[model samples]
Target: MGVADQINWVDAACWNGTAFDGGWNTRLATNQDVLEPATGQALWRVGVASAADMTAAIERAHAAQVAWAATPPRERAAVMLKAAALFEQHFDELALMIARETGGIIPKGHHEVRESVVLCQLAAAMPMQSQGQVLPSTPGRLSIARRVPHGVVGVISPFNFPLILSLRSVAPALALGNAVVLKPDVRTPASGGFILARVFQEAGLPAGVLQVLPGNAEAGEALVTDPRVPMIAFTGSPGVGRRIGELAGRHLKKVSLELGGANNLIILEDADLDAAASAAAFGAWFHQGQVCMASNRVLVHASVVEGLKARLVGKATHLPVGDGASGQVALGPMIDAKQLARFDALVQETVQQGATLEAGGTFEGLCYKPTVLSGVKPGMRSFDDEPFGPLVNLVTFDTDEEAVSLANNSQGGLSSAVISRDVGRAMAIGEQLNAGMVHINDQTVNDDCTNPFGGPGLGGNGSSVGGPADIDEYTRWKWITVKASVPQFPF
Candidate 1:
């Protein structure tokens, strides 16, 4: 049987008041097929659920969350741990599906799945780690603050890194005792919804505690606007994020949004050219440069500009571009046809604005070659816009002040990387950059599970969704105090 016959497109897992009961509609349409450039064969057809069904599921989840939140944090952590183990056991399958559905290379897809599992494990350990402080107040009176979960959290995830991002929100929410109603992006729902549902079920979580409603913007908007859903965690475009924020604000709902970014990479004169070039190539071309944190703009010192440009061009050109399912392929196609058009327009606009195309400016089917542009001015669309493709714009600077100024010129403050042999100089330069996270002598892909990670300014709302500190973002703190001696005042 073909993939379409074997897989269910509209697979719904909902909490119907008392229990989880929903059927998988395999015949559902993705509206199009993801075709391989070489063979022109269909890889998958992702489907979406209706908005009405998703709204009902969110209501059901909210009803069940009241009881689930009453459970102790330690018990909830245990369930997360079990789910983590199940995810690890089926990592290969999950990875394969993610690659097929999202057009990410196999190795990258596997890495995302591994990170998702690690996120679950970290979330499992969050209950004990989510500690509050004791206030230094009056003597003989004890005052403490405790963190509590938001009732029912609605998680809206993106297409890129479907499994990891979805699990990132769901695991933390679950660990904090918040029942989750997840809405995976319509483009790659199966990769996240299918694996997560299977893992949660295998871990023996109660049906209503976790539910997946895979659908498009209508379903996502419905889930977010519902009053019962008190918190929303969204990862997507800035325009959509702004709308979500406005809606949540009107309804008095708490929201954490990780939006789009045009990240910059700064390479100083004292930097190691070989290492910087390799890091730049990875940051610009890895996963087809679809990541929100990907270094779309590069500022290199004029002294080493020629050498760095040569190295980057060579490295980017050699990367194998093909279908993600092919294990040898280093770069994959853009997420969809619309994204390809957008990327093409950005490149063309930059060229028209007088930027010189250095390596590539061609497209075959949905595959856009790793493209590099030089002589790009600061205000061009390519320099200012978010190119969600394998494209990098390079600019040269003479002094550290100029480099910092150019880097901070944009509105995005998601992430930045500085490559230098001198650790002290790198650290000093890193301090001057206005990004939320910085990497010295390395790329910006080093996201450890033990450290807080999030974008800044227009890129993010200063909310960390991973690491030991992430639990704080998912919960609210309340203070309690008791009188030392029942006030000796007579009535």
Candidate 2:
């Protein structure tokens, strides 16, 4: 069936050069149902490509990348520019599809699509940027360095913010003259995988340059281990990222990992309580706190903890929560039952261990209430581990040193924030915190295509994406040298 026959991309299961209903090899075909988290409805069924299918996709991508690399840089940029225009043209339809496929609220879907447009536009500029540098060499020689794409790139993207994360790597790789074989999380096949293939194909990207394979662990392992694919871009948990890193290392393939985060939002005593509370609430509950940059830990001054707690409770209690596609709800449902259970367990364990549940410790179906927990201290489950949910753990601190110490006491080092009236003090505190990206007056959940994204430690592998970072992440440096004549003495 055509994708437009029903919802935007209902039957878009897998695309290997062309959209197909079953796997490339029908004998090994397997299908998995894609379910909507808010309502337990099956949005579509995706063909779960096996390891052999993944290998075939990689081989095809490798073959296509050579000609793509030889193509003129302007032609590549033109393709990216067309993709960006197409994204804008179909903005509403794509937003609705994101909402239906991923349970994202309408506004969040719009935001994701908007970010995607920026990503595509940013990629369009990459092909024209200076890829190398000229260096001074010996008297009779010239030395130069240039950037070039690494044949075929393998991408493993996550479900949350599927469109942005997938396109973050996919668009740049293609613009840099590399073919890509993308494996989006099985739960978000349409928005993350096949939909991209359709958009790029419509944008005039050549056949076989981009392959979307939505499958399970077998396919992921095959993609990582394949000798033909030399680079892997992954975004998900630290566990999976570590595994991919290990396998990619064994095979000598370069890998870029944008992994998990247990982010912090620090509130100082001199800060405005109302503004701090608002930032905390938004950071903790935006997209139901499914983001890796969600403010799981909110560290406030001991003297003003009570005031901030009251404000946070009021905001959490009043925020609407339900199906995102139905109306203007502030929070949407958890992605699935497994994620719901994980969040619930952390809250339960924290409360049992003596953290007071200030408000919202209830859930109906997948819609978890925007929750707040006070008296939460170090060693608490919610404080130590990343509760990727709409639950905020409030910890009290006595001084700026304590606040910085607490914020740095985690396995994650992604995004963080500081809110205070004194701009200088906020900047000082933010600088001391060991995080990749820090905002002085904003919340933790902030992102843009112009800035470098990804952090140190478990947050990522010291690799970044966006703007100039793309040249480093998607391409490699090659040094070239020329001499006026062959040296006779060296031989």
Best by lDDT: 2
TM-scores for every predicted model: 0.90, 0.95
Candidate 1, residues 33-141: lDDT per residue as tens digits? 4443334566554445566767677776877787878877788888888988876776776676677777888898789878877888888887767367888878878
Tell me the number of clashing residue pairs for each predicted model.
0, 0
C-alpha lDDT of residue 48 in model 2: 80
Residue lDDT tens for model 2, 1-491:
32234455333443322322223333224776789888888777767879988887887788888999998999999989898888888888788778777777999889988988888888988889888999998898999999999989999999989999999999999999999999989888778876677778778888788888887899999999999999999999888999999999999999999986679999989888988888999899988888989999999999999999999999988999998876679888888999999999999999999999999989999999999999998899999888889988999999899998899898766899999889999999988887889999889998878888889888988888877688898999899999988888965
How well does candidate 2 score on lDDT at residue 57?
Answer: 80
lDDT for predicted candidate 1 compared with the true structure: 0.77
Model 2 residue 325 CA deviation in Å: 1.1
Model 2, residue 23: C-alpha shift (Å): 12
Worst 10 residues of 1 by lDDT: 12-21
Off by over 4 Å in 2: 1-28
